[model samples]
Target: MSRTDEHRRLAVLAGIDIDNPELRAKLDEVSARTAARLGQPVSLVSMVLDGAQFFAGSFGLQGWLAELNGTPIEWSFCVNAVQSRTPYVVTDARIDALYAANPLVHVDGLHRYAGVPIVVDGEVLGAHCVLGYEPGEFSRSDLEELRRGADEIVALLASHRLPRAAPLPP
Candidate 1:
């Protein structure tokens, strides 16, 4: 697909609202469906802000998720998505000069990655990404779907007004 088409698709997908209760449920449902439909190993809703990564929801694969919560920016693809403010799709991390040496790509053997940036009101918040153990490529439709999913996640966060949890008095 053309670059413009990709960006436009991302924008359209990012416009979905995930804050509403029904919408949030739908987002989760769709995420699960997408994972199955795409035959991917893992699908996740990730939010990046400042230096932390939050897992709003996930489907497929387990373990290390809790540890990943509130993780630093350096170890995350979501962070890279936000910093670059674009969708990153790596068909083969092992062949990519930039990511080949990255621990997540090398040691973890996460060879394939597809991530779309989540932006709200002109500010990049995080990303929603899908990963696989083997190298793979995503079609335009796949990228658009991922972008929409990410947008829904952003909307969910935006709808909530709860204050950030404060630590108890020590």
Candidate 2:
């Protein structure tokens, strides 16, 4: 599927309020715990919306990106995972052809990233990812930890979703 199609589907499936304090707090806790588990300073439960990559949960983020809780889809690496429905890892975005023009690589100095697709109800939503300012590798075990974190985040999101209405009586 096209990126736009994927994003549109995700936006519909992820109907929970991003601004809900209770949900955001729970997501933030997951991000923080995942960051510690992976020994990374930064982690995010990022959702690729139709127009932006929203940080549904974030840890160790600073400055404007953190303040905004998101960025344009053009600036997002998580979108890669969403599109591919697979993990996206960049050991050094600075030199990676795919990210050479991405603003976050040059402007934010984010050189490393490892992300797993966040799938809920069998649809790819976005990513659960770790960020690093310096170049590095993500071991297989690290990806597994991220996968577990993604599962936890999916559960949190599901809990916040509004229940389906009962079918109308004939």
Candidate 3:
């Protein structure tokens, strides 16, 4: 299967669409704590899917971006984090030519970024991202802490009884 296809498949198998309010609350707590710890204005635990990303948890996220459960992958900076397979940091996207074209950088005003892959069963479930509205440096210790926090988030996900999509009534 194509990588995107496999990602979607594994996401479904891993209960990425879980609707458990209890678990969602925990995820929300994670998001809040991450944003506070990183001193970032926004943080999200996103599930990167085929064409979009669903917010499993979030903090300080709003606006038109607030109205939905997820967003198109093209608009998601965390997509890069999920693909990186390691903690990724963008010191300054606005001034960085490499990231100048990223929609999240130029369009949304999300500047510096630090994130880590959230893995389960050796598959990338999605990513945990801390988005700063201004350029800033992320130290190695900061990145390592982000990775550790991601591990804790993964632990919460792993311990849950994966609730799958229920079959539609005939």
Strongest candidate by lDDT: 2
Q: Can you rank all candidates by TM-score, best first?
A: 2, 3, 1
Native-structure RMSD, model 1 = 8.7
Provide the lowest-lDDT 10-residue window in model 2. 10-19
Q: Model 2, stretches more than 4 Å misplaced? A: 2-8, 165-170
- lDDT, candidates in the order shown: 0.69, 0.87, 0.78
Task: Give the alpha carbon lDDT tens digit for every residue of 72-124 in model 1.
Answer: 55657777787688998889989987777777777767888888987766666
> How many clashes show up per model?
1, 0, 0
Clashes of 3: 0
The model with the greatest TM-score is 2
Task: Quote the lDDT for 25 in model 2.
Answer: 94
Cα deviation at 63, candidate 1, in Å, is: 2.8
lDDT of 2: 0.87
Ranking by lDDT: 2, 3, 1
The RMSD of every model to the true structure, in order and in angstroms, is 8.7, 2.6, 3.5
lDDT of 3 at 102: 75
